[model samples]
Target: MAEYLKLGVKNEPAMSQASLGFVGRSVAVAVVEDISHNLDPNLFTALKDAALSTNPDESKQAVKAALAHGTHPEDIADFYIPALARDMGDLWCADQLSFAGVTIGVSRLQAMLRALGPNWASDNATTNENASILLIVPQDVYHTLGAIVLSSQLRRKGFSVKLFLGGKPEDIANHITRTKTDAVFISSSAGETLEKLRQIIEVIRGSSGATCPIVIGGSILDVQEIHDVTALTGADYATKLPDEALKLCGLQETEKKKISARNGT
Candidate 1:
């Protein structure tokens, strides 16, 4: 973990324009395949089109259509948005959409995420707020909708989650030291960002100490082996599953909390 901080945030590879296509296509196929079964195919297409459209109300209407179709908001946020983000990335890589078009699409998706609900990022449903998690997304990461949705999911499960979109390693360390964090989750998207993860993990270990577990997730995990990421970054665990992450950190929720969250009680 000490190795993580030496390189710190300063060395994160800037996502050059040339590599954007590579990064986009690298993970898109897997993401598309993952959500194909869970989401309504028609609704997914509508959301993608709305996000890519210029009309501001188009995305809103798409979301409304989803709700009217009896789709849950959580499902839209968790499954659909991430899949759509990847589809947009794939489109950009295929030259079907200009860079500016993809950017607008991603921005609209983010706006829709915020509109999911007041508690999308924080749920008071669970009384166990003592267990907390720090969810981080390096500044270079392009798709953060997954991390945000994960935050909501974790909060619903009774964990107090603190999410950091992007920040310097020192800032991250300082925050970890200041807060009583049980686990640290760093989400990465591109292959070029792997080395930077090593640095960030090091910083997290440096400040939070070896006792606190670090788990890496996001699109990178979809394409890479779990062992590869953990071995490279010196993270305690690497997975996209929240339950596994919590278990690794020795903070898994009680069965009662889990049941309650599922029952929406």
Candidate 2:
């Protein structure tokens, strides 16, 4: 985990860019395939197009069809949904699409997620027994889809996560202590200026939960910004993506111990 922070946020690899044709392997394929074997081409394209569509009803039909055909909710959430976002980001940068379009796209995707609500929770018995993790959406921030995605991934990996969508620092601290949270995660946003990061960090530091490690990230933080934030704040670790956040917080690996114990290895 320390190694990842040291290396910092990576540009989407050269290989990933070349494989946009859906002809090869990448983190998306590897991660999504592990959860579901039914990677239907139609399902994949349906999700992609639905996220970019302007019409809510049409997008709903595509997302619903994918779910009805046995594409797992977790798969859609973690896999195809983020891909659409990235694609939108690229288009926006190139001025081919408006930011408003991207926002609408995500709203449509969220509709699919809301529709798939309960199935998103993990059924793993070990997860229910795991230590608590608090995912806080810090003050004044609205979108927390990144944190939500990490929470789902963590739960699937057998960690108990409590996502605090919005709250005061003292209240957040009280909840963390009452739950005996093992760690906490928070995110700014894609365009965060970090003008208030220091204040936000201080609030977390003053809390009873301050002793637990805090991992922070936002889309705006490039490799240099990540290092800068780490240097300027009480953050123990940083990453541009939530998967790395889980690794740095050391939650993603805990499930391995359960498997080893069951095998008596």
Candidate 3:
């Protein structure tokens, strides 16, 4: 967690050695696969060794250095999710697993902002006041890291956002009905469970009676074919992340202004 914070603040050199030890080999591999071009090999080697080390302090320092090297938020997110999920089963209270997932997801998002720099949000803000949004993920889409990261980005950009995850279709409909949401974001990482996402979208759209925007995302929709699937199922917006989806929905500027004002900038 300290590594996550250090990366977010761009205080790369300040990360404690112990924090790096928590990052695992899979995380190192993911980081390399995602950002090897931007990072030094020696730093990565140190991270890998730390991940593999039995010594707790050495491992922590190594992970800290790798994080300090910085990588894209999406890649960081991908690296953190599995590691978080594995550790969650033992660390989190049984009833709080979902909350833990949300925390892990948001932390990765902060890491992304750290790696990508804060200027990324500048390109997408809008002045429109009517650009409210709602981000919804299917009840079974337990991998909330992507959605949470996207939500954090959108919130930072000033969009009015209501994040809902892992709920029944009826619950989704009820929220849409009550909020009159301008957009709905859905995430489905499951390969075979896409039908469930479709059904929920259809149900929400049909029940809303208005042509509310629907966005679909996740590993399943990472493919071009899934874009077509999203269209076929009546999703008006589709992207791999919430930031991109908001761009598709024409709310970028409005969100940015809101964020800027909130930050007193």
Candidate 4:
């Protein structure tokens, strides 16, 4: 990652594995390391520039070049694309990019992910009911790139993911009542109020009969502390890591566990 992209983002101090419980922390660390190791910095720069360029075809050409270099489509969708989105968000925060610039960049990223094919989501779904999830972005929250990327991630993890973007609390609750959602993951932005989250979560709880686990994530988690979200929103858990959220809901098994079970070890 470029140092310039790190502007306005809070950096966490180093801590021992024992100081923080290692299980979830280790998983998050491994995820970061995996993306950093696989992503080509040069290609990332090109992709970022292309996505923000005036011509829409520039982004496609960049993605084509990435694929030609033998880059896995999933890697592009999961790691490269999300990193670009995050950078755009950080740039917007630092006043380096306007809201319009970030919006355009994110739209291009979404199109690029879609061009990667059905395999990015559906091919990996495996149609397991246990993996069914409802991903929500509360009404008035403008930061949707993270939610879109997360939906793709969850789908690629074999979860049947549904996105409810900017829906009213009553409507969101109605959908929850109709769907077989194993968990409800809400993606919120920084400017959104805690009272709004509380109200939405309250409605979702009523609709879900208080059985579904509601996990809040997105840029809100980046700016606000996790403990504060859980405390203020009546959420079951709070984290930006998809794996952690799913594990907390008892929906997703660890990769190690999945591999061991598959290998009969």
TM-score of 1: 0.78
Candidate of highest TM-score: 1
* 169-211 per-residue lDDT for model 4 (tens digits): 8888888888777788888765567889999999998898998
Query: Which residue pairs clash within candidate 1?
Result: 4-199, 4-202
User: lDDT (CA) for every model shown?
Assistant: 0.71, 0.58, 0.51, 0.71
To one decimal, what is the Cα RMSD in angstroms of model 1 from the true structure?
9.4
| Cα RMSD for candidates in order | 9.4, 11.0, 11.8, 9.4
Q: Candidate 3 — what's its lDDT?
A: 0.51
Error in Å for residue 194 of model 2: 4.3
- lDDT, residue 39, candidate 3: 40
Per-residue lDDT of 73-161 in model 3, one digit per residue for the tens?
44433444334333433332332223323344334433433344343333234333466566666664445555555554565555556
lDDT of 1 by residue, 20-80 (tens): 7444633232122366678788888788777776577888888988888788988887788
Which residue pairs overlap in candidate 2's backbone?
Answer: none
Backbone atom clashes (below 3 Å) for every candidate: 2, 0, 17, 0
Q: Please identify model 3 stretches exceeding 4 Å from their true place.
A: 1-129, 190-192, 241-243, 253-265
- lDDT at residue 113 of model 4 (Cα atoms): 83
Error of 4 at 233 (Å): 1.5
